[model samples]
Target: MKSTGDSKETFWKEYEKLPDAIKEALFSEENFKIVSDICEANGITSDESKSKLMKYVGKTLMGKLPIKDFFVTLELEMDMETNKAKAISREIDRKIFSGLRIALNKIYSTNIAENKIVSDNKRNKDGTEIPMPSKNEYKDPYKEPLI
Candidate 1:
């Protein structure tokens, strides 16, 4: 009965507008090495793999795991020397940043889209479902019959 704009999009967009520092630390030099090395070693270097890794890191961030602990887990998969990983981190910083940024954007976008779609379902004030009329019915089931 009321319409103006999509609130879910606005909420996520507001979150995206925050300073990079405040954003979830989904991007780290250590994370990049862990992911890139594994993907390369498995001959699976691809955007899709990066996306999966991003989701993994994003989950860790959302879980509020300390940054240091996150790298420890990542190293289990990567195993690059600390010094080498740190240096390699700088070299691939741009790619790592871009991948993370894209990953977060996709995560937020899908989350908002799914929520908006779920919210579109019509429900009673008491949250009871109303049965719908069949196609043979004269009136639209989704709408109340006209007076």
Candidate 2:
């Protein structure tokens, strides 16, 4: 598996290969706003939200998680004042990004679990299960050390 830096580099490389129209659509303002809103809800400041949004957006695009889950619509709406056209979108659900955050968290937890030496199925080197001794089998260690 590639490290995050490698994956990030690969994502950007792939992003650069996309057509201008596709790139523009994928990184549209609606998506940015979604990212910013997510960051703000999680206590990230407005100043840092843009960069963080870009990072997560890149991850989402690169990871290829369900885009439909995050965004509901991508229609053009005319601005009432200038009568100019603008992209209007609605997020289907906020839980989508929250779920993505959870998915990413699982990645970290999985790594930790994988690196652990202990297994869930505990056993001794003699191929026998290491069972907890009963209280009656215990000795008073402070009085005398057990041999």
Candidate 3:
């Protein structure tokens, strides 16, 4: 696996190749919600919270950083602006991760899906085939009356 810094670098390199509309979407408010939730959950209150979170956009998508740790890192990296942010609940945590995953997929769906298709084909090539289901396994409970 690549080092965190390397993965982050890779993320930015790919990020730069994205269209301007995608770049705008990357900074969109819904995307920011993931970072905001992470910060709140980890008790990181800061005006710069979102900006700090932005720095790891690449690492998170690259899987170099766990989602929670990504937030924790942001918390550690940013100066706090307040202490009133609420802790993230488990449900909220799920939602935040779901949202991030969706957003990242939207941004890199083609590349991500291409990799998956290639890997799946390789695995199938190297593995045994699954058996097809047998037909006519069940018997009818009642027979029709003879004319």
Candidate 4:
């Protein structure tokens, strides 16, 4: 929700200028705000932000998809470098999003753990027990499972 830039074009343009290897490695990373915020916070030059984003995106992909499937699909669709590049770029998008969601989940868990510790000692307005966060770990533990 942070104001990352004046417009979205700046975001995509920043993304495109990255080296082909980096662009390819991003695995379709799309936490636009996360990328923009990191860039802004770290004072990374545009080029550096691009490279860092690609690296993080790679970190994202290392968990969700098979490297072999990624390349095989790229080759299956491509008769040319540009086409292969575009195809691979699109392919990684899904993984980038998946990775972002995974990160959010982890953050949610940590917050839950924090909450649980605070809530466990309190009671409902009706004077009922606030059960200890079902999970004995982390903040925000009393929050119901979002699933």
Candidate 5:
């Protein structure tokens, strides 16, 4: 089995290869709700407390914000003391990050499967198989159905 660091590296590699549309989907409002539900079920944060965290997380995932900024924002937005904000950040990272990684992997795997299917169906004029596109080639976005 891969170590946590190895798996995380692999995850980010795959994440970087995803189309922008799919990357956007990973941090969509629907996914935020899913993460919120997961966190709420685990008693880490109340519904009222999640919005700020979720927004920061989304920004972080999109590469638009730093996590340190998230901690500060969490403290200010939720009116928590500094230590409380740090504790909540740790809890959120522990509880929510794993689930988000799993969701991203699922999305990435589905995209690979779909791309393979599309590539497999393609053939030359002489009916010979053509190679799959390079990593930079992005097809249409595939939307996963919400459960």
Candidate 6:
């Protein structure tokens, strides 16, 4: 198990190992514009929306947060409707997640060809495997109650 600082350092080291083109695409203005469009479409005028979106994007990129959790966070923290949040998540998946997946796959294949250790799972600082949230834990905000 590593401390938070150690884990962050390791993450940054791995991030730096990625190709320059991949890094550039990950932080490109197009991606930023997509986030801004989402905020603006949802009538979120506050700068906080952009800040929170970027924060979640960073966590998602680092594999510290799941996309589902990002949707939940956006719905809760930004006062967004569930459908709007889900649409935003889908847009992000289409625009950002696909590119990230391709880049990661390329990196993974290269690492494998070089016989480098590739971790299959992310763990907590205590060395425990990070568990996915149950459906009950992430109930849809707009879901109707059962009779």
Q: Report lDDT (CA) for all predictions.
A: 0.52, 0.47, 0.54, 0.47, 0.63, 0.75
User: What are the per-residue Cα lDDT tens digits for candidate 5 across 91-144?
Assistant: 656655554565545554665576664344468899898777765794557956
lDDT of 1 by residue, 34-96 (tens): 667755754546777566555545554343333335444444545645654444334333444
Query: Model 2: runs farther than 4 Å from truth?
Result: 1-13, 16-25, 64-147
User: Each model's TM-score, in the order given?
Assistant: 0.27, 0.30, 0.34, 0.22, 0.38, 0.56
> What is the clash tally of candidate 6?
0
User: Which pairs clash in model 3?
Assistant: 41-88, 46-81
lDDT of 5 at 44: 47
- Which ranges in model 5 have alpha carbons more than 4 Å from their true place? 1-48, 96-147
Error in Å for residue 21 of model 6: 5.4
| Model 4 weakest lDDT span, ten residues long | 59-68
Error of 3 at 63 (Å): 3.7
Model 3 root-mean-square deviation? 9.7
- Pick by lDDT: 1 or 2, better one: 1
- True-vs-predicted CA distance for residue 141, candidate 3, Å: 66
Residue range 16-35, candidate 4, lDDT tens digits: 54445434545434455454
Best by lDDT: 6
Report the candidate with higher TM-score, 1 versus 3: 3
1-147: candidate 2 lDDT, tens digit per residue: 569989779768877765454465466777677656654654446565447445534545443433442222111111112211011112313433443445444444554576668645568899887776677996767776559
Q: Which model, 2 or 5, shows the larger TM-score? A: 5
| Candidate achieving higher lDDT, 4 or 6 | 6
Candidate 2: worst-modelled 10 consecutive residues by lDDT: 78-87
How should the candidates be ordered by TM-score, best one leading? 6, 5, 3, 2, 1, 4
